[model samples]
Target: MQLTITYFALLRDQRGLDTETIDSPAATPAELYTQLAEQHSFTLPSSALKVAVNDDFAHWTTPLKDGDTIVFIPPVAGG
Candidate 1:
């Protein structure tokens, strides 16, 4: 399936890009993150992030489909 992913904060810095579209065999966000973590050497684990699908907050186990837009949001600190 084809997925569009948006990276933010630490994830974006680690990935070195804000967004990307790629073909993947992952069936869920959790799976996708694991695939990406390995491919990109992301420092944070999936347990440290929240996921969203198509702009809506989604559970990690949410079923993924072709053309889905997903974001893996990392923790943020503000002054």
Candidate 2:
């Protein structure tokens, strides 16, 4: 599937980019995240994250489709 993934804050720093489009075999947000996290050496796991699809909050197990836009949000600390 061809999807656009948007990385934010910590993820953006780790990925070295804000957004990217790629072809992947992952069937769900969780799968895709796990793959990217491994490939990118992301220290934060999906257990500490939230996912969104097409600008709407989505479950990690939600099904993915071609042309979907995904966002992975990591926990943020604010003063």
Candidate 3:
């Protein structure tokens, strides 16, 4: 299926882009992250980030479908 992925914070830096659309065989966020981590050499683990589907916070194991927009939110720190 084709999905849209958005990156933020460290993930954006690592991915070198704010968003991208790609075709993947992943069934869930967890699987997609693992695949992406390996492909992009992302250092942070899935446990260190939060995922959102279609703008709503979602589980890492949330089912994905064609054209779903996914955002992998990295940890943030500020005063």
Candidate 3 TM-score, C-alpha based: 0.94
lDDT of 1: 0.94
Superposed model 2: Cα runs more than 4 Å off: none
Which residue window of length 10 is worst by lDDT in model 3?
Answer: 70-79
Per-residue C-alpha lDDT of model 1 across residues 1-79, encoded as one tens digit per residue: 9999999888899899999999999999999999999999999988888999999999999999999999998876788
TM-score of each: 0.94, 0.94, 0.94
For every candidate structure, what is the RMSD over all alpha carbons to the true structure, in angstroms? 1.0, 1.2, 1.0
Q: Residue 60: error of model 2 in Å?
A: 0.8
lDDT of all predictions, in order shown? 0.94, 0.94, 0.94
Show pairs that collide, candidate 1. none
Cα lDDT of model 3 by residue, 1-79, tens digit: 9999999888899999999999999999999999999999999988888899999999988899999999988887878
